[model samples]
Target: MNRDPSGGACAAEQLVEAGVRPTRPRLAIMEAIRTGATRHLTPEAFHRELADGGVHLSLATVYNTLNHFSEVGLLRRVGFGDRSYYCTNAAEHHHFYDEATGRLEDIPGAQPQVVCLPEAPPGMEIDGVEVIVKLRRSRQYPR
Candidate 1:
């Protein structure tokens, strides 16, 4: 982990390593996401977090920054229906989404092997595969 002058961990160095210029808002956003308890966060949730910390960034800025981070390989964007969540783990992996809580949790270890994929068009090729297993409480066993 990288540390700031005050000896506290910060995301500035990681941002630079990811080829992103670390600005104040960017740093704050990165730090919040990196150190936050939740592994995945939506743009609106991120905005609220920053506001709670007294950072006061606009929702547009939060959305743009998260997208920029995804483009630069610093984060990964996972879509579920009409909502999108930003994940700090950018590596290829699968996830388990809880329908009851709307939480996304990383599936440990390597990605599962996929079989018998259809060939891509003449000019295109499949790049990667992402699997999301949705979970909900069983009706037979209420929580």
Candidate 2:
């Protein structure tokens, strides 16, 4: 019922089909994480935006829902350390997380360079895999 007319209607539909109740708070959360300029975001940052925008959602709820979304494959978790980020992988592709700026950018599956593995490590032939290119500004400048 509560949806931005000009916002991500596709995300909304996906959420519904994914069995997630599209509540107002969930809609707001989805809209930000789904259609925002920023891709990689922590739960604190995400909830901060929701609060800053005057959308009444608690950080706890955001964390809970994000966890659920990840489990349901609606989103993907990036990074390994304490610094955590989430990205909506509605499209099947990889991602590039810029560490210097702490941002996540989607890298489409259709890339100029293709990597193929001839043999499997063990008995597993092949499964879906992704590559995250974490970027940072060059620190050195040659004279």
Candidate 3:
């Protein structure tokens, strides 16, 4: 795995800093994600990565760990339909979801503009906004 950009904090150190126990599986999982090709990953993909890394962990364990990490603010969970993807980037940002390839990418630079919004109900407040701009290949191209 490549060294963490911020002075090289290992998986164990990252877990501990996030107030999570530095267990073997947790460390391995963190390493798998931090070293992955992409930031957005579903449980199934993560499971395959773990398997390929020679780390034997059940699918249930992978799910549970992901859930735990999300709950502890170590990861962000993005849901679409019946599937959930875990994102390693916890910073506030939007996503571009490709319908054709079922891929999700971070929308960098600036936050999207919220032009208008209706009033909230009694005693309610706006928590936050999650914008997912879905995309698909154009069909008008000459074949």
Candidate 4:
């Protein structure tokens, strides 16, 4: 619907653009992920949605496609500790997580504080920072 006249090929086209094969399962999963306004998605949640649509894409396929997208920089993984979440990489400046509701929100133009160590005893390199801002609803009610 992005106005590509190819017809039934936009999703597949995006796949190829992301350096992935334009396969049926990948296209279908991509549609499912792009259904909502929010770009964030988890493979588990995506699998459930696909199942609801009667699509029999294996979980392995789902994970693989997600990884493929991630590898190609079309998607990004968001998580805290060990819980993993997924999001499209249109703009991944930052994120916010609601502890009470389990919801994830994108934060635009955020720069986190990065402190440097005094010395490195061995060979090591530091990657970019991944900040997870956890938030919760205040218990006290207004009114």
Candidate 5:
């Protein structure tokens, strides 16, 4: 899928393909997420961005839209501490989170090898694994 946010047509088509209605608010929210300087954003941050872009959406609306998108596989919802971040790239992948800056970046092409795992309980199965590597500047080599 095209990652460029400028491609509104692509986003609209994606929304439809994900079985979601391509409404104005949904389209705008998707575009904002795709076009954001940072690909990962919290609902509060998204609300601020949409408001700044003149796409006045309620905070509740933004949260609900993001959750819906995540549910439809249009986005990925990642949890960090007490907050949740919506990632535009829904593909299964790892991430590096900078604790100091609260920034989350994709760990490109690096899928950690999981050698073994305990068997799941009866009637349950392991769905997927998510790895989040936390990073912090060392005092000796602070940036």
Candidate 6:
């Protein structure tokens, strides 16, 4: 929509199926996330990607689009302390966040098993599970 129009129409179709209007900016955002060097991105990274591709969007728009996509199950939100990242793989799985490189990778095959969970509040229900395993290289001192 902002630059390339070829993928915009297809993106619109996909967005429409997801019950989203598929506006120009939304289409651009989708294209940015779906086709990129990395599948997982924080809002800041997403904005940078858009910029690199000659597509301009405000930070608020990026946040809004990420929120909307997550609400519709198109993206998975992974959090670390105070930071968050959005992933395109919404399948049931966990993540491995590399602190050294600030990269997120999918850990598929098996989801985390919770032995016991506290009872939900009255009239409340339990949602899905999200586990993020942060990793960093172990430092070795001089022998």
lDDT, model 4: 0.71
Candidate 3 wrong stretches, greater than 4 Å: 1-7, 115-126
Using TM-score as the yardstick, the better of models 1 and 4 is: 1
Ranking by lDDT: 5, 1, 3, 6, 4, 2
Cα TM-score of candidate 6 = 0.82
Clash tally for model 2? 0
TM-score of each: 0.83, 0.66, 0.84, 0.75, 0.86, 0.82
Worst ten in a row by lDDT for model 5: 1-10
The alpha-carbon lDDT assigned to residue 4 of candidate 5 equals 61
* Model 2 ranges off by over 4 Å: 1-13, 34-38, 108-128, 139-143
Candidate 4: where are CA atoms >4 Å away? 1-9, 108-126
lDDT string for model 6 (3-40, tens) is: 33233557777788789998999989887766653367
- For model 6, state the Cα shift of residue 115 in Å: 3.0
For residues 18-118, write the lDDT of model 1, one tens digit per residue. 78899998988887776654378789988998999989999999999999998888778998699899877777788999988998988887767789999
lDDT digits (tens) for residues 2-96 of candidate 5: 37633445778878888989899998987777764548878998799889889998999999999999898877889867979888878888789
Candidate 4: worst 10 consecutive residues by lDDT? 1-10
Please provide, for model 4 over 1-143, each residue's C-alpha lDDT reduced to its tens digit, 9 standing for 90 to 100. 23232235667787776678878888887776665555577788888888999888888899888877777766777767667777764454678888876777777665565577455447966544677788877669633
Q: Candidate 6's error at 102, in angstroms?
A: 2.6
Task: Itemize residue pairs with steric clashes in candidate 1.
Answer: none
Model 2 Cα lDDT, one tens digit per residue, 18-65: 788888777777777655643556899888888888877878999988
**Every candidate's CA RMSD:** 3.9, 5.1, 2.7, 4.4, 2.7, 5.0
Q: Model 3, range 12-72, lDDT digits (tens) per residue?
A: 8878888999888888888887775448879988899899889999999899999988887
lDDT (C-alpha) at residue 36 in model 6? 52
RMSD of 5: 2.7
Comparing candidate 1 with candidate 3, which one achieves the higher lDDT?
1
Candidate 3 steric clashes: 0
**Cα displacement (Å) at residue 64, model 3:** 1.0
